[model samples]
Target chain A: MEEDENIKKLNPVEMKLLTHIIKNEWKTLIRGKWVIGYGLIFLILTDTLLRFGGGGAEVLLSLSNVMLLFIPLVGMIYGILYIYQSREFVELLLTQPINRKTLFWGLFCGISTPLMAAFVVGAMLPLGWHGILAQDPGASVMVLALGGMLTLIFVALGFVLGLAFYEDRIKGFGFTIVIWLFMAILYDGLILMAIFTFGDYPLERFVIAATMLNPIDLARIMVLLEFDISALMGYTGAVFRQFFGTNSGILTASGMLVLWLAVPAWIGLRVFKKKDF
Target chain B: MNNYKPIQLHLFGGLILLLLAWTSVSEASASDTAADIVVSPDGPVVSIQEAVNMARPGDHIRVEAGVYVESNIMIDKKLTLEGIGYPEIDGNLEGHILIIAADSVTVSGFFLKNSGRSHVRDYAGIYIDKAKDVVIENNRLDNIFFGIYLSATERGVIRGNEIRSYERRESSSGNGIHLWNVKDPKILDNKVEGQRDGIYLEFAKGAEISGNRSNNNNRYGLHFMFSDDSVYRGNTFNKNGAGVAVMYSKNVDMIDNIFENNWGTSSYGLLLKDINDSRITGNRFYRNTVGIDSEGSNRVIVHRNDFELNGWAVNIKSSSRENQFTENNFIENSFDVRTDSPRNPNHFEGNYWSHYEGYDLNRDGIGDVPYRPVRLFSIIIQRQPESLILLRSMFITLLDTAERIMPVLTPATLIDEKPKMERIR
Candidate 1:
């Protein structure tokens, strides 16, 4: 009976934390006038202009490839920042006799609330627009799920970054930028250089392993290659085909992206639990 | 005695069961081989190669639109593998679509993935290793180790194929369409990207690499090393890794190609290293890091080409000699020429430079005043790249003008006399 009672109460801590986060998320969105106003305006203007730009819909779909990457990245940063900045609130909650783990989990949910809202809004645009343009439900869902996964990943990332540099926002932001650049440009550049200079020797296995490390590259290639094999039917396309052409490659990539989401969140939670702030 | 009795009974029962199971398993496997073969739109064979096994030569195997988990599909004979609605031939997480080790094979209209990518084994979607007369066309190769690999194979036509890769890690990736140690092949009108190179040739001789758009690739759009007597015409190589590098190759002609917008600090439109007796004529280079970058290249005739708005119109290192740049248009570029060697490795004659301000007094097409192509500011920037921020300033403009007037503080030997005032077109 005692064991049963403990089991029943085990999830209460998680529930309470989750509820607190959800409530805080609403508050942040209501107060986050600048982020909402600016970000929406920029997205709308760019999206509308792109719609008229011929092959804009496809390009939009392609650009939405970042949804999986940036959403997780940005959301993670924003969530961690919110929790880090609200140290006084966290301390007040700690004084209320709530468990430290519960408080951190609550903070996690609260920060993620804004990111979730933004994600839904961001995803809807692509879906609605794609529906209007191409009447493609499959494409729309793919795009939306892509966006959703991205948001979760980034929100988790934000948490990790925030927790990692709780005392230094500048350092955290700088590190994020460096990571973004590495994933976006530098990594690809380096990869190309290697492939070109070492064409004689076979190196496909290494390329596949390298691709598993970057979430953005993984999502972009997965979506693109899944939709149209022709999209990557090039030099590097061959490498992609070799790795992701099978259920195994897809599974591995998906597994890696999932890890990218889970590991960061886990780390952030660990940090949030131990940190004085 | 008591322990032995229980053990003997257990062993006797186990032996009998094992014999029974072995016979049943063999029968089941034998039956499965015959009944496991399926053909349908949705509940079709789990793999294309499995479908291939059920198919005879000249059989039209129609595959549906879904993901099939398979790998190392060996097509040993001639067949038509067609996807009804682009059924994905997945290499079962890590598999190759159709590795054709035999000749006279034709693969078309299916999404081929996972072509046996090994640093050791040359895996390809339609790999013709030492096979001949293969026709691979109209197939979309995605994320393959190699789109269509032909090694030591001859008389194959790879046309209307789109091979691409997004995994841009250097040392361990494959090319779009790789032809190694092959001779007399025709590769035409393929759009390949995201690979090491779009169309790569290693020791591939007497082949025509024409009418292909290879862009956004990790390496060169078209790369040929030690591949000689080949013709690359009407190819567009844009935004690739180092553009197109043809090294240790001879008697090659690169004509009517657009090598442009390949702007990396160390990239070039066309990099010819240690190439001998090559003809680069009627080629257009626009907005590349260095158009026609030649190092240790000799006896090359470059004429009637447009080198417009590149970072450096012509980059000839000291090792290059007796190469000619004639009737080429150099317009609105930062540097007309760049070289480490003190002496002129190549001659520049009758080329149009946008900065050329000279009169044709004799009414000849060539300008009367000699045009010094190298600017002193460019030299300064070469030595100290940070000084590029001073570009287009009054000081830089004045310094360049002075350098052009006197030829001092600039490489005097790097002058293009008889500079045409207009484009050769």
Candidate 2:
């Protein structure tokens, strides 16, 4: 509601300028052929997985594994590289008398939306074609929702990195890869280290908090909780007397994920507004 | 002198009538020695105990429809106690409803309830001891400590009985059909629920238990120890605290049974411990914590069974050796087979595993490459169960993929050499 009022406060000329920039971003994204290619990759992967990937639920599990590994990597790399490649375009836009908020929202939506839409639609079309939508709609939709949230989150983080290292492109690329590697791999290693370090004390709460901190881990947990409930259920009380993937757990994870999607982008926007470039 | 003569003549008349009644009973059947004695609420014989007292060996005592508040009604004669209209025999929280101490006794079509619980006594709706050729069937026992207790009996038939109780704790509850030191017992077509163990057997040999639905019990649906040469076929055990457990038994045949939805930390569809030379075939184990937990079990032939959606389909411990698993289908379990030790002596062949990614190139039904059932994650789980929280995580999958290419932590020899290309129906 507050956002709408702020948009309403803008005059007709500013509104036209905002819409014009957003339109230009969308046009270039479509003509770039990245979204179509991204969609095709998911399409073939999902189709092949559905056909030969151990019948029904096995296929879904394999697809989720692939999506968890690839979605964030693609989203972040594409987000940062898009900004680096389009630096001249951004500069040219700044020369025009446009509002920075309008430019920020335009760039944020322009890069994230196409990738998110391509992923969700590509993953969904094959499932519907195979009647998995009617068969097990809850799990299927949950997988897609997790993928969508992951794309938004990683892309937002990408924008933050892109803006932070605007002066040095090589440093920006190096940091983005390191960040992805840390979030995806090293974070888990750190968690294991902590668990082993505090093996005697009840470190279940610490482990869960650490997992929730990583957006990729949160997404993977959400998808696995839906598919492999029984095995995970066995783990819950068989060792630690803690619960995993309850309805409340899913809700809290999603709330954290929404924060993940917004904070990094908000930080990037703040930096953009204050920069003297 | 005249009064003595008259008394003697009356005694002589009574003796002649007794002889005629004896002759009539002998003319009925070759071995029959009595007549049908009807006991009703309004009849001369008002109670079942009174009817049993008056009946001779091989007599038929028909108890009509009435609530007979009785306890410890002992049948010492070889008689048939038949309930005509489903008569109720309420134990009134006292003790055993009926005790059969004689062989060739048949108790059927009775509604027995409320045999009081006691720590010292093995109270039951019907307690049979040291009897042979006994049949207890077509009865409904409710709120019993032990539904039907048989001990030191031979060739006993306990069939077509529905036993139910309300006790939730195993310490307070007792088994539905309790058999001990019995031989050649036929337990068939019974439904037992909410008991400690649905059907329990110990020191029982040549027992044939089939067509039973033992569900939702406090402990195992069917539990047997030291029971040799027992056959469990066509039984459905569901939602029990632990599913059917067979321990300290040999030459056991378990066929065509369904064990489902038994979910607990230590629950299993079939827990075979210290069992040897057993045949487990044609069974469907679904959605349990573990399908078959083979611990200290050996020489068991596990064939043609369907294990689906379990935490671990088959958890073969290191102590269990020389067991053969063939022509079975392991589908959609989180881990197909898990073990702690890497030294495996058991054989897995011709089973269709859903996790198997091997292809068949020779146009044969079996795959060319061997499929390893044990994964690296399961090994980690066995050692550090806390790592189970990382189930389905990317690290575990990557670790498993790397280990599959090079056998390191998992059981190196535990591979299904002849994996089926397609599911075995």
Candidate 3:
């Protein structure tokens, strides 16, 4: 029975209902103001701290990396947690003519817009306020492109988190925080301890793999190191120098961040497609 | 009469149509081509604010040479303010000259000075707040509290500016250039001096600080905290109270810089505190109290540098771990390396210790005997600090010799296994 349910084809009517559901989700996000406000405050504060706080560039960059996970996580909670509470809107959309796939993409795009806006505006601030483009226009462009991709990845993550617990808002919120905490802080701490314990021998190779797995680490390696993989080719950096310290490593890491966005989103769509309203 | 009437009517119609087309074209051109306003003797409005008022989007404002006494000049339009002959701008009582609220504005070639002092608030000369694509370059700032402040501003190039603050009595003052919540900033080739800190960064990302001179500051030449993933290269820091302090930051690369003459009772060429996963390579350190004093620093690689005439080459304090020091030259220093505690988690190898007295028996360029960098007197001085006054004394030399012979009083972990008998280069 489970296998049959898994293989069950969506009829035209169900597909249409799914499309309506996603469309309503998108509309709801566009009309909301929470994501914009959060992004605005974050950008303003980050800029202030960097410009006048007497801290150096490394501190600011690292801080920005930690903040990357929060925007999408919060956006997901706001988008998905309210689905059940949005009973009338969901019912009204279900009564329309659309498919689940359409609904998934529509909802994804709808909720992702504000997050994307926040990313663009936030990213643009560094380019202008710092005037990095005037010195190296090429680097500024590269940062912008990377910023755009990173924003999309985070926003898609929100969709997955949102869909995973549309049924239970509290559990979903808890799950998002856990995932963020694991990725941002706990995972690295555990990796460092492991390295210290077993790192008497040549064990940096394993540490490199573990660091690359974390999105925050990968993003940092890709951006801060830029294309100078040779600089990373030292004792501890040798492993990073060998892997993400190279051209192939940068490409692979970027591909990984993209996968992080796509896989979760696909899973969320699958769940949303089968979810009974 | 009939011929005249037809000709007159046709001519009148043609004239009317011509006039209509001419007016339409003029309006179209006027909407597209914005006005260029000059802020000097040539044009109206001697102050920067007046020029800002006259400017529309996509306009250029030229500022002439003269001391313009103003504060909080708002730039709300996309314009270029190119100063000729470096106009002196003094920010009296209120702070932050040329506050940019609009994007794509350029403030270049101005001698900015005398910003307002505030204990509670840090002020700036050219403050770009929440603006984008701003260029602040080739400007001279004197007695400025904070120069080229950035907040949430991106794609900025703070290049070729001479920023210097006077020696203020208060600790809160100084910082030649500052950045906060900033991203993708290129702070290149700027000379900063006489401030509490030459350059400071916080919560910024994707930044490159290169080819800058930071000297004669009361505090750190370059101070970084809680930041990550940044590159600093080809910068010279000299004669500061402390040279380059990096704290609570990670994934950083520092290369090809000279750290010199930062001498004090307690100071270093570079101070690494709670730093992790960083690379320090090809940097020269000379005539400083301590070269690279690291505390609670982890997972760092220090290699390929010249250390000359420093009081102590490297000082490793407590809780520093997993660091490797290699391929560095330690020449003419009173002490090569010293530590406070008896135990150390770091490893040192392949460094050329000039004070190594061991003979190379195997002809493999490596000394047969292990080189002890930390002397008993060095440890005692580290503990009592005041004992440093006895440096180079005959008594301390005898004590060091005794400790070297016995190897009991000095920390067992503070020895270099493969110290080079001769200099590599």
Fnat of all models, as shown: 0.00, 0.28, 0.00
Ranking by lDDT: 2, 3, 1
Q: What interface RMSD, in Å and to 1 decimal, does model 3 have? A: 18.7
**Top DockQ model:** 2
For model 2, chain A alone compared with the true chain A gives a TM-score of 0.91
Best model per lDDT: 2
User: Which pairs of residues collide in model 2?
Assistant: none
- B1-425, model 1: which lDDT tens digit per residue? 68799889999999999999998985774463332234444663566767878767655556667777777778777665666566677664354567776667766667777666678765666677787778777888888877788889887888888888777876677788999999888998989989888888999989998898999888778889998899989999998977889999999999999997786656789989999998998988876768878889999999999876676788888899999888888765656787875578679899987667687887777898888887887676555442332333334555688778877677678778788855578
Model 2 - which docking category? acceptable
What lDDT score belongs to each candidate, Candidate 1 first? 0.71, 0.86, 0.72
Tens digits of per-residue lDDT for model 3, A1-277: 6456546777777666656555665556557866667667656765664563322232243334434445445544555555545556656666775555665666666566556667657655754676644655554455445555655665566556666666677786787778766765566556545654664566555655675676655665565444222113211334444564357776777888788677777787777777776
Question: Roughly what TM-score does model 1 have, to 2 decimal places?
Answer: 0.54
* Model 3 residue B89 lDDT score: 84
Scoring each candidate complex against the real one, what DockQ results? 0.01, 0.29, 0.01
Tens digits of lDDT, candidate 1, A186-224: 665555456546655665666566666777667765564
* Cα-based lDDT at residue A90, candidate 1: 70
Between candidates 1 and 3, name the one with more favorable lDDT: 3
Q: Which prediction has more favorable DockQ, 1 or 2?
A: 2
